[model samples]
Target: MISQHDFRQNVSIFENSLKIEFKVVIKSFVKLNKLFILWLIFVPGLLFSSSKNDSLLQVYNKHHSDTIGLNALHEYARNLQYEDFDSTYKTNVLLSNLCFSNLFEKKNLTARERYINIYFLGNTYNSQSIYFMEKGDYVKSLELLEKSIQWWSLAYKDYLESYKNEIYLGLSSSYSNKGSAEDYLGDFAMAMDSYTKALRLNDFVKRNCDSSLLNFVLNSEAITSFNIAMIFENMGEVNKSQKQYSKALELFTALTKLKDERVVVTGFLGTSNVLTALGKIYFKKEEYSVSIGYYNRALQIINSLNLKYNNRFNTEYADILTQLGIQYKKTQNYNRALELFDKALTIRRELGNKRLISISLNNISSLYYNMGKYKESLLASAESWKLAEEAKVPQQKIKASEGMADSYEKLGNYKEALIWHKVFKEVTDSLTDQESIKNASTIEARYQSEKNENDLKLLNAEKRLAEQKIIQQKADMASFQIKMWSAIILSLMIILSALITIFAIRQRHKRILKEKLLEEEKNRLRTVIDMQEKERTRIARDLHDGIGQLLSAASINFGMLGKTSQIMESESELFSSSMKILNDACTELRSISHEMMPRSLQDAGLSTALNELVVRSFKNTSIEAEFEILGALERLPQLVENGLFRICQELIGNIIKHSGASEVIIQLYKTSNEWILRVEDNGRGIISADTENGIGIKNIKARVSVLNGSLNYENGPEKGLITSVKIPIYGQN
Candidate 1:
């Protein structure tokens, strides 16, 4: 009944939001510490690559296409991204097939191990994404990057809490790189959101991680800021762009103060790029002196890094020189500008990029015209034009043609200048025409798509109308049958009424008796609990009022005796130890009474009571604890509050005595229609089914059942146990 066009249009929203992830087949204990993980993973592949045989063959021979063979294939394919990916086409296809097969599952693993397993899977997709990006296939790259984000999110959530920050750093890197893929697909808005997320994650990691990671975090922060600034500049928001650039520079300035040499190399690279960007911004604003200063600063850093790191920033160095030369030319410093331009041209030639070479040549040609060297300017313009054409960049062609016309005019060649000017005007017009055509095509495509969707809707409407007509004819045919049965049904109903009334009378009496018995049981339970609370309160009051005061008075008298009399030193020490014993007994007794019934539970409510419990329980224990509440809190029915509080008290007692967990968290939160109490510990969970039948667990379940609530348990062998109890607020009464 569904039309094809309608189905596709309706499903695209869901289709585009789907996430694809996989688990790794092999296990490894390698630490996941940022992108440094790449070194650990790829170093093995690098060694295999240099072996006496081909690397892919070596991988196959080593694993023989078993489970581990999948891991080998993944690493092998990852290494290929840094080389010629086409050289091992079969390996790429096999790895992709294995990852998409989803045959492996995460099981029988610790939280940390499971985190590692999913992280490896994420990196597998990241490797493929990098390879496709290098090959200029952004659609496939975007798909894999999105998949990697999915797997990494799982890893981030499942990782050992102690190492969660490390896992988050890896996820942040994926987001930042994913933004690049989005940028290539012409989706700048999504890209901006992605970069913002990356910076925010780094802000979290910076506070909690080691100071050694400061350099790495700062560098990433600066890079994301620089990327955001570039997007702003592209959208023609100059003030906003300058603000982001300034933020990036400030981060870079801090990074330079760090002492980590390995990451400082990265800091230098990012810092130089920021400087170059600032120089360009100033140049646009016609601040020549300021622009020249910034460009030279960037040039110095790029030049030093290149010298020390084996030309690692050779491309950056060339770009800086070209920009600096343009600034110098603006100031009419012809000789110095020419020198810088020549240096840039030489470097671009070595790089063998047609576009960069054309850009350099055009800069020199314009400078020559400025210097009144018409013949030299014309020659450079002609060469630049040829390269621009080869590069297929229309903007470059426009600059080259305009430069040629200016050179010819300066030479007094009137006819040649006129012809070149006409060519420049025609090329500019053609560029505008091309943009108009592209826009028209986009509009036409949207119109066609909408028309197809509307046509499908019309067809579905017509089909519904035809089905309705058939239903109407069938109803008319059934009218005579209904009339015949009406009298027979009425007679049968009269006969049944007498028997039905007799049955109802008997059942109603039984139901009333049952209700009376149930109410008696409910009253008994309420009476017992109330008696227990009254008993506890009476004992606490007596202990605090009677014994506690007596002990305090005795301690004061003992202290006064020691101060008033000059007792011998050893005698004084013995008396002091006796006093300490009495004092500890007083403290212990008071604590027992508070534990039996916390004053806060009755005085303030669950949120304050839970916080007080955590403070009292962990004040001297080795275990760490946390308590949180969500949503607004109001006093609940007294029985509900008491039951939840007692249940938490028992849960925490069990954890402290038997769980061996170093960490625990208690949460009491309210939903719109329900209240939830959750207690979790990173400890040995239930060891066997019998553990659930223990007295403490049964007591918790009993309390939940009384409140018309449900309880669920998550037990982990390697780590963690969580107890979740949900009670409906509406139906309890």
Candidate 2:
């Protein structure tokens, strides 16, 4: 037979050998599948690009008139917006200059020629605005958007009767671009208004345009709606954001049914953006798993499009990866999260985008902080801060500084931590101030615009009234009639006020009655709990006094019988076994009685009772149990103490019976106004099914409900299960 130490050594060797084999298998699989994986990643983008290029080539081969050629050029440039950033901008600039010098400067131009020129110019300007917006130059982007709107307005004025829908599409595109810039500038109200206007224009285009043009307008509407959703998301209006996102998704899904490849591709990309935005909103809400699902769907579209290497696609992919990493981190998949973060960082580096790089570094720093690698966290945070400063991005700077502060605190460097914390606070305050100023400006602009419109309406009405007064001479008599009716209106107002007062009084009484009912229900629950505890105490007393004494007497009598000289050897052995069994029965009864209403709980209080419970539960078991108490462990009310003790007992019992847990920790702590009890076990987590059926869990919930405490069960950071209960300690100093 193998000794215990030898057995342990053999198991250790086997585990080591198994791990080595697993690593070798993994490496071999990766090597064998490398090309297959690369092909999967590369093929979709190639097909998408090939199809798109073929369409553009056919247009170029047609060699239409200069005007048609210019239209084709614009379309080609638009398609390259995500594919080749620099080339798209240059092409748009060329197209803009060509339209201005070649067509706009011509004398005696036809209305058709002028309209085309204006449309092309507007389209070019709008495209340029988008380019600048992506580069983080919101002011420049906004200026170009305004120029685009000017050109679109000219086109609308010149040919509204003939091509109103077309002009509306151009104007809508321009306004959407404007909205994006305003959103980036933190002017959420303005962004919302711009997007609203864009949506309205797109709706007009959608209603009046032919099938082909209708699909285009629908895609634009989806894009504009997505922008509005993002603005709402930024403004913290979750319901509005979600509503708009759903609307956008519907529009984009419809567009996907179109036969036009360009429209179809645009629809797919738009859908992806909306999906990503939804993910961001859910991530903000801390619905990590839900957010991950949305993000993965978005990634699937990008993969399908085979556009992962496109500038915009790369940024989107990196962001998705980083966000997915964060969710994985929350779920405590540390190694997998680290791998994702590293991948995101690599992509950001390849792109050489400072803002994204800073974001990636800050995320990595946070991951390190969570992993307790403080020095590495500090290094990553410092680099992130430097990059954020260079990029002049306030949000990234705040995140990096906060990360650094946390790292310093973890490393026991309070001075450095304080310094970074102050920096983080200052930057956050600055950002808040900037947002406030933008909001004030947006409000003022809206007020001024509304006031001007109102003034114009008032002036127009006054002029019309002046003309009517001259034509009618009885205007003064009409004014007197209006004054006579005002007195009757005042009496009606008084009556309404009286009615409102009566309603208010009724509401106050109803509120008072509701409060009384709640208090009575609480009192009833308290009585029930008291009665239960009394019954338990009574039972424990009876078991200890009645059954326990009888069992002990039986054991003593049996022992006496076994010692008699007249007894045969066989009879004596039988007597000895009976006595031993009786003794064990007596001991078990005493233990059960003690457990029913532990004397230590009443004599020593909650902390000692919990500690003793932990010690007894795992006394000779393989499991290791620990108890910790924080803050002042004052004696709670008897009811409260009893409920807490039973809760702990139930959790421990569950752990031992079902968890297969190797280690358990029980903590009881007091805060300023609450007592918190936490029982955590290194075992399989409590699944939903287990929670629904477990009698012990049900009992625990009842006790917590009686105490008006909250009970929460969740997976721990690394593994196993954590249960936390918090009860407010009322009237406690």
Candidate 3:
């Protein structure tokens, strides 16, 4: 068994081995070919790096030393603006892959780190997408920008919970980039809407207010608006184009007044761009002086801020100079025009700004056309078209086409001029339509996604509430059941207590009544005994003095006479009948005395006494009575035993006299708690209502009361009469 420490060590070792393998793969890939190494390193860098540091290989190398060729690749990408299509394409592919890899890894990172990395990936994708757009690959550009948006959205999701403003800023920037892509693809309307949404989101967070950032935003917005204005102007919507250009100028002018270094540099560039747009518009309007004033302003700002915009500013400044040269040519100032062309051409060639070079070449060609130097002008315009095509700027292509048309027309080649003019119109028109379509689709997609998300959230909230109500209902039902059962059990307890109290009270009442009846019976017995004693004495004296002497004298005299007379015969029969009557009365008196108080019950015990009484009472009747005794009936009180025996006798007598019953059964059982006596007969049942206090029933009830017993009599439907009595012998108070 491994100890915890050893287990931890083993895990650490495993992790280290995995990390080493990862490092090996990174190094091996980086060491392959220079271009391949750059591709490998930059892709991961863009994929893994934060949004702020979008330079691919530099970001990759910062993360791990394993990216040995990353720094070299980053340098290569920095110089990518000068590379050919193939080089740029390869670089973009690498950057796109790097961003994808970064996003994959970013999922496992902490929320903050993940957000930063994904944001970096978004920026990389955005750059590549823009590059693709520049190459006239709108589909690929759209795909890359969508991926960028997705990543940025995820990053925003992570950030929104804690840093609401930061995420919103990121979202605004992502949307702005999307707008730019759409704009480039000829989707002007959708592009404008996307840009508007971005601005709104940007305003929601007040962080990007520093002059540099503000100027950056303003310049971007102005450029996009200016592009739209140029489209409108080309399409012959002069007023709309002017409106957009005016908006662009307003933003650019505001930036120029700012003091920040970055703002001042961007403002100068923006002001020049606005002037150039104004010059185009004025040239279309045939307003030379107004166009010249804007053109001159553009030239002054560019020359003054030359160092601020780096080498890039030289290209725009050169184009403006060529346009000025054209303006001079149009006004027939050939010397001044030629002089301006030379200055613009030199700057363009030096800076390798091919598009600007083409423009300056075209201007020189046009000046020659004005001077009637047809051969020189034709050669110049041809070279300018070649450079324009090579530069790959659509606007430059248009300018080059116009120059070719002019050169052709001046040489009396009207067909060629007309052909070039038509080509220029067709390309610009197609570009406008494409841009417009892209813009519309983008806005629609965004709006639909937001609406669906909101609807889903509402549905989820309602579902949760419904589930909560169901749970609460179940809880209430359970509580109700518990209370109901509690009430039922409580009621049962109360009923049990009441039954016990009633039983106790009834027993007490029975005991009192039994004692009272027994007392009354005892007093009656004493009075009967007293009367019997008095009668016995009177009879004895009468027999001795009168009847005895008379009977004796008569018997002796009659025997001596030996005569059969009628009077003597009658007297003898009468005497016999009288003696029989007397004997039956004496037996009945003895039975009554025994019934009132039985000596056998006192002497022979309950079972034996019960047997004797049943045999004697039923012997004279047709009833066949059976007496069954169970348990040890000896321990019970004499009074209780005697009372139970009498109850059995009374029940049997009722069956014999009233029911004309043929059979009677008496059962005397002495259980631990009580003595039970049951008497049943095949007889007409006694009516409990009528016979409750009749002589035999009252006597039995009195005796039962003395013993504190209970009696139950059922007039059973099939079995005639059933009487049962239970005396709780031990619990008697």
Candidate 4:
């Protein structure tokens, strides 16, 4: 929609912008003049204003093979990058050659020395990246900066701990410069990330640093604050930008007040840039007076610097003047606004920066329209629109189109006004569509990135869980093996202990049984011996008392007969009596013998023998004995028969001798399982306790016990004594 004149103007602006950039590039490489060396030696400030320092180069050359030389060269390159980027790049290339020659791969270097070389290597790359950023090669700048980060990471890991802060400062500077280039490239997200990382490092150093490093950290923080403010400004968050600028300004002002001559220049430069940003922010907020005041303060700082830096300060001065002009136009001070715009235009023209010049012209056109100078506004806007197109600055172009439309409308040119309005609309719409498409693409990419990240996280977690399970399983297996071994050992101990104990207990029990049996046999033999001795004593007493008395009577009668000489019938009768006494003595001896071992008891069974015994015993006695048998009169075993017969004899003798009863009854009975004997006497109802426990009774009990039979002596119901013995016919021997 531009006329031929506008097209020509556009071509001219493009060519002029190229020429200006070439001129700037050429101007940046200032060579040192030997003639000025004496003058520079007199004024150190002026000495720093030059792009090169011979003394610094000499130190770098001398130490370039060592850490000291590399560090000096790095300082030299850093100082020159802003003023002369080509020199900085060339210097770093030479420094890299030195690193390559001396210590980069040399194993002879100490860890600290190698660490120093690595940091310088990264620093050199950072210097080159800064040079590229300043030269407006953002892609190359980002690439080089990434290399710097990679190399510096190695240095950070191996460097001395006390010097880690230096690496941190260097890294922060690299990231901040990277962010600036990204911001220029219109990569806001990456720029924000870089800025945030830079601030993170800055804050860490600032928080942990001692007083010696505090000023350096403050300087870094101030620079980072200004860089982040630009990001906020671009994002249309002017308030946030204002706050960040204010913070940067505060730090820079404090640094400047310290007047540490070594850092005062950087502090001043930082303060002025912050002030310029604050002025732009206030102008955006329509605070014209405040914006104007901030603009004046920044200009004053630029003016305060040495005149030798006029070229360095030119771009800064023009930017502030343009902001002041915009503010004055907003406040309705058309004349003052025009004056400020003209001043900015002259500076931008002299500087030969077409985009910046276009910005000044756009502002002038706006101011002219505001002042009702329609023709002047139209002319200024048309030129600005052409320059903006050449500069490829779409926002400036759109603004210039708006200014043109307004001027044409005010001048009552409907056709031109309509055309310019359409031009503005088309360009604005195109930008809007492109922004929308970019936002959509960004959203889709972010979603895919998040999904991939989540999937990776899940996979990593599963791998960790599997690894932990394997470790736990191994531990459990080891513990189980230990426990199994312990159990086996304990079981063996327990079994061994049990065997020993059982053997000891069994031996003790066997010994006790043998002693018990030996004791029982001795008691039996002693009992038998005592019974035999008692029986012998009883037989001897019987013989000596009864037979001796009878014989003595007989002997006396014979002696008397011999002494008489003449015989009488009565004396003859005394002889007869002596004979009869001799017969009776013989019979009594037989009875005693029979009682001791009765022939009838051995010859006949207990029934017949017992009957015969009853017949003989009571034949001449006053007390009668009755003997009765029930069941069969079977012969028993010899021991049983002998023991029973002896028991019967003892009972009969006791009855005959001791009982004062008139009669005795004896009964022997046999059953399928046992033999029983009962002897009752109608004598005294009860015996005294002494007679009950007498030797004869004891002997009877002993015999019964040997046959495992029972004997009882109790008073009968009719007032006699009853003796009952029961013998079982079961293996009676």
Candidate topping lDDT: 2
lDDT of 2: 0.77
Best by TM-score: 2
Q: Give the least accurate 10-residue stretch of model 3, judged by summed lDDT.
A: 1-10
Greater TM-score among 2 and 4 belongs to: 2
Ranking by lDDT: 2, 4, 1, 3
- lDDT (tens digit, per residue) of candidate 2 on 644-730: 999899888888888888999888998888899998988988656865577877778778877888999889888899999998899
Q: What's the TM-score of every candidate structure?
A: 0.40, 0.49, 0.41, 0.46
- Each model's lDDT: 0.71, 0.77, 0.64, 0.73
lDDT for model 4, on a 0 to 1 scale? 0.73
Alpha-carbon runs more than 4 Å astray in model 4: 1-52, 78-114, 129-140, 154-163, 259-262, 306-311, 332-335, 349-355, 365-733
TM-score of 3: 0.41
Q: Write the per-residue lDDT of candidate 4 for residues 161-199, one digit (tens) a residue.
A: 757677777778788888887886666788988888888
lDDT of 1 by residue, 1-733 (tens): 1122321342334323433322232233123442354344444445435442255546655663345656666556644432334433335444444443332433454554444445555666666675565444566778887767666665554453766566667656776777766765546899888887787778788878887666667777777888888888867899999999999888777777777654566577778888898999999999878887888888889888867655646668988989888888988999999999999899878767666788899999999988888899999999988987765545567788878877866676645665666667676675445443343333333444556867646655775697688778778768766876887798789779978998899899999999888667656655666687788888887887888889888888987987898999878779889889988988987887787777888898777877888899888899999998877789988888888888898888888888899999888888988899988899887635666678887777767766768898887546789889998998666
Pairs that clash in candidate 4: 63-69
Q: lDDT, candidate 2, residue 420?
A: 79
Q: Candidate 3: global Cα-lDDT?
A: 0.64
Name the candidate, 1 or 4, with the larger lDDT value: 4
Worst 10 residues of 1 by lDDT: 21-30
